[model samples]
Target: MSLPTSTASPTPTRSTPRPATPSHRSGYRTGLRWLLQTHGFMFLWALGMLVVLVAAATIIVSNVTTPAGSIVQHARQGLTWFPFSIAIVGITTYTNIHIGAGLTRRSLGWAALTAAVVMAVAYAALFTLALQLERAVYGWTGWAHGVDGAGGLFTSSGQVGLVVLDVGLLFLAGQLSGVLVGIVYYRAGGWWGTLALPLTAGPILLATPALSTAALGDLGLAPRVVLVLLVLGAMSLAAHRLILGVQVRKLAT
Candidate 1:
């Protein structure tokens, strides 16, 4: 009969699966890489400039009078503000770009925190080294190499560990505070951010061994350290919460 009309149904074709989105771990790694790549060179340039300025200041001060106190410490404020400003940009500009790249806010927050730690350690090490170098130079020139400020953790630059600890905590606080200020502004606008500055920026003040000691009158190293850690922890938690709930907005052309 009509060659037995085919009754078999046609086979269904399989659809290709879409590629998987990046994992949180991958996003964190990518975000960290992006932050360092974008900011590392500028940081180096700033460091180099600071070194030159410090050298010139040292020479001038030595010629005028016996160089007393850490010249590098006097310049420490610049170091603090530089990274603070960078961390602010990391939140305000990089956050949106990071999300647009298909990364999660959690990854960006972790990356930013990691970057701040990395930078703080670097600053502390470099600053400590600078102090040691200045001490050596002062020794050669028969000048005093005392650190400025009373009731501070370290009186001598020879106390390498304490110097590093002090500087590291201070820089870390400054960077974290910058992140807090940036996010507050991003979330709550200018007026609130400005008003919140005393609270948002308070960590840096508390972390400063000189300032904190001055205000609290030598609460002892352990107590000072504990206070700093508590402040840092609170700032980090607040920033983390803000970052998680932040809305990604379109950029203007």
Candidate 2:
């Protein structure tokens, strides 16, 4: 009886390892699905922006009289409008996200983060388009645009002194958003209620620099005046953010 046992067959094996964890797979799909859906609104928004942007872009090329300087002027001038318009629309998007997130406690962070990420991407696209516009127009005639110039960190101008200005502006805008969000969260401990102040301040702050540097200061503000406006406005708003934050935390405690 001991010698009568039959040999067993080999077990089957899996050809592939299991895919990503179920949670990870679902999160990835959810993010992708969300981006696709939200991007429709962003696309529609871009159409309106295009009308303005294309006009600005073509203005330099349109003038047959000042062909040589038009492109250069356009590039230099467009920077001012670039940041201002973006800040305006961006804050709105941020507010929308904050509101949507507040729809539920569990989904709030994701909603807010999604808004920020989408807007950042939209901004980058616009920034790149603006640069390409300048480059195409400026480089059209030849290497020389009738002005001896150096390339700024991202511009045809020099990077030395202006890089600080560029970085400073971007950082300031970010700080404006963050501080506002923090203060709002601290004060009321809710999403929708916290967004309006920061969103409003960013545009106003953006206006100062945008007008100062925008296409030859067509806004009529002197560069120095614009700088003063920026510093003062930024400080006021930031202080407001802090005070409100303190009030929020005090109530919470």
Candidate 3:
């Protein structure tokens, strides 16, 4: 009886396999979500402000003795600085809080990068649309559309693709410079950050050629565009490296 009982083997049990994890996709989505959370309202606010400024400038310039062309110049400069200021403040102010809340520095850097690209594209599109609307309104109102060299590449060249590239590069440079400044300030304090001004600002200055109608010395469109793209890439890489080992400071500090 003992031998017979031992001869029979127990049936094997199969454990359920763990679900596959899409880590890269999850990480990318998480980073994108974080950026949207942080900068989402900023974008909306900037757009609203831009509309108001454009409207006010248009009305006053058309009615007063002011040159109508100044409106476009004002808009262009405003858009250029909007993202720059936001990024600089946001990165310095929020990076520690974001890390304390469970996000990695790398993740935040990626998020910032994504946010910068999206912001640039949106700004370019919105600026272009605003100018086009202004043109239509001017035509309907029998006022001259005074867009000239100050109108930026898209306004002056009337090329959507070119303007997008130009504006996008400008914003990218601004965004990168802002992040670079933030990192410099964070790691080296205000004194070193001030000392690092030229290094941090070089990228933004490079964007001038792309954003302006003024001739880039000895550089054609192709060369200028290439230079801009190269500067953007270099700035992005510098920002990334700077963020990798950043020490998170306490809120009070």
RMSD of candidate 1 to true structure, Å? 13.5
- Native-referenced Cα lDDT, model 1: 0.75
- In candidate 1, what residue range of length 10 has the lowest lDDT sum? 1-10
Ranking by TM-score: 1, 3, 2
1-253: candidate 1 lDDT, tens digit per residue: 0111221221122232432655555566667777666567757876798789989998898789877777887757877888888888778888878889888887777777767777788877778888888888888888888876553467677888888888888888888998899888887778998999888887787677543456577477788788888888888888878887889865667
**What TM-score, computed on C-alpha atoms, does each candidate reach?**
0.86, 0.39, 0.81
Clashes of 1: 0
Give me the displacement of residue 220 in model 3, in angstroms: 2.4
lDDT of 3 by residue, 86-115 (tens): 778777876776676655666566666666
User: What residue pairs clash in candidate 2, if any at all?
Assistant: 77-215, 150-157, 151-156, 151-157, 152-157, 152-158, 187-248
lDDT of 1 at 121: 84
For each candidate in turn, give its C-alpha RMSD to the true structure in angstroms: 13.5, 15.8, 13.0
Name the regions of candidate 1 deviating beyond 4 angstroms.
Answer: 1-21, 209-212
After the best TM-score superposition of candidate 1, give how far the Cα of residue 136 lies from its true spot, in angstroms: 1.2
Give the TM-score (vs. native) of candidate 2. Answer: 0.39
